[model samples]
Target: MSRRKKRRKQEEEHMDESWLVPYADILTLLLALFIVLFAASSIDAQKFQQIASSFNNVLDGGSSIMEYQAPKQPELESLPIVEEEKKPLEEKSDKQKDKEELEELQRKINKYIKQNKLDDALQTKLTEEGLLVTLQDGALFDSASAKVRAEDAELAREISELLVLNPPRKIIISGHTDNVPINNHEFESNWHLSVMRSVNFMKILLENEKLNPSYFSARGLGEYEPIATNETVEGRAKNRRVEILILPHADLQP
Candidate 1:
């Protein structure tokens, strides 16, 4: 009977171990919740990669977890944005009208040049930017002289009349020379020749007081701004000429 009682007591002791199992299960559940919370809190992809790499190193028993900041990408500043204002329609139409008028005037000048048989002595060209009137050296003046001939007076008068009848535009008179130097007693060099030529022609053009003197200027480019090469006589002859440039007025109808 005593042995049976002891066996029963041992069985009861074994049943008491079931309470320890519940406590162990509770601890396991708490540990699992803690792990989930830690995982949720540290969710950065770069941090995760570093932690995984660290864990791999630890598993191999190599090194401790290394904490390093991620390399930051450079931030580029935004470029300035500029919005252009559109021109008005009236301004555009006015520009077109000015261009048309300039073309018509160029045609009229060419007709005049042909009618007066001045094409041989002079050349007229309407360029992309302005009109160019070139007068040959012999046609305008004698060799090494800045004096305008009596025969050229008629041509000058015609040009002045045409300009006065038309819209006002600025005029630029320029003189050029060949590569050969001048040794005149009165003039020092080719620079003087070019400058005197421009000045004399300008003086004749401004003979009329009614003409706007402020609209004209004279410049001497010497042999530097030649239109042709100095290698051939013909080229040098072509370079020794005078140019009358008519520029569109900035504040005029254009």
Candidate 2:
């Protein structure tokens, strides 16, 4: 009986330990899976792709589960800079063209005034109102008369021809007079004289077929809007004048 019990104990000691090999293999595979997931979470896209390609090469025996690709940072960043650089240059170019046009018109009128020997009676200036051409009253009309002289009428036609070379804009013909009161046979007061003078001058300008009538206007300021004092003869003469204002184009308004 003792011999039989020893045999049974020997058999129990040798009980199968082969099942533990497969269990160890399963645990190792689980650890490898966890390591791959942790590595994927910590790496950038480039490094992750490289690691994936290497793993696929090693595990799949030359067959690949991942395709290598370059990062897309440069393409996304360069597109907007190219598109945003062109707008301000275009706007500046348009403004420059308009400025050049205004300067050219001023030069032409000044040249005309100098060549015709009318510089003493006519003056040209660039003002906020536009190109202002001022003419003394005695140059265009006789005392208390609204009729333009024959030579001055020819000058008006020349000016109108030059003006029509530009785009259509406002042309204001304004008349001013001295402070001396006048009630003559033809005019009731200074107001009537001023208004008639402006109308007649504008009429001569419109005789040029190239000038558009709709763009011209006339204003009579009488003795109220004087440029000089009324206390002296020279000042009074300076105050009696006519002004022609040529406005800038509509798109160039400040």
Candidate 3:
């Protein structure tokens, strides 16, 4: 055979049989697959939550986290702590409500006094301690006498009516006397007169069963705690009076 023909035959016989096309196709598919896998695995928890939420929207109406085992029921003793936690909140709410209620009550009393044209005879005040209703001695009693005057008895009845509706947290019926010392037959001293006055006034209030005697208390300042100086007759008249301090129950710190 000719050398050229022999070389041609050898070339044909030794031609490369590599499967490059199939191998390239497989490599490309594997690369694409790995890219898809990386994208799926690299998703953040936020994305996961969003996906779960979306899926839940389409199917069962709950998130994937809901499927996780719920926390075990707390121990029975721990339940008490739950109640304890709620107690202070409830107490605070009650205190706030009570304060508002007392304020409303004060407003009502003032309105009643103003409507009835008793503004001159009575004055309602909101003090740091509580509400105070100061009834001047001349308006409610005879001069230097423990007896509740006939005209003043009507005022007392009116006040008692209001108190019956909304009783004082503690009705401290304090009686005050002028600086002038008392040396009368019925009363030995101003102190005695002051105390007797308070006692007598409290007795009148307690006559109404609606007014709780347990909550009612009486005291005699006896020229002390004067609202005005005793330098003048008018000032002494102002000083000689009965003050009903409606202490708020919420403010009872003790």
TM-score of each: 0.61, 0.69, 0.63
- Predictions ranked by lDDT, top down? 2, 1, 3
Best by lDDT: 2
Q: How close is candidate 3 to the true structure, as a TM-score?
A: 0.63
Which ranges of candidate 3 are over 4 A from the true structure?
1-92, 165-168, 250-254
Residue-level lDDT tens digits of model 1 in 1-254: 69999999999999898556455445544544444356556456865666566555544655534333433444789976543434456567776776677677778888998898878778877775567888888788888888789888667766766566355778889998898988878788888899999888878877866578888899998899988899999999998898888876575333
Model 1, CA-based lDDT: 0.75
Candidate 1 minimal-lDDT segment of 10 residues: 64-73
Q: Positional deviation of 115 in candidate 2, in angstroms?
A: 1.2
Predictions in order: lDDT: 0.75, 0.79, 0.72
In candidate 2, what are the lDDT values of residues 47-123, reduced to their tens digit? 66665665556455553333433323333445455545786676578767766776788898889988988888888
Off by over 4 Å in 2: 1-72, 78-95
lDDT of 3 by residue, 1-254 (tens): 99999999888776754323456445544544443355466556665555445444434533333233322333566434578788788878876776676688788889989898888667888776777888787776776689987766767867877786453577789888888988878987777778888888777777777888888889888877788889998889888878888777835432
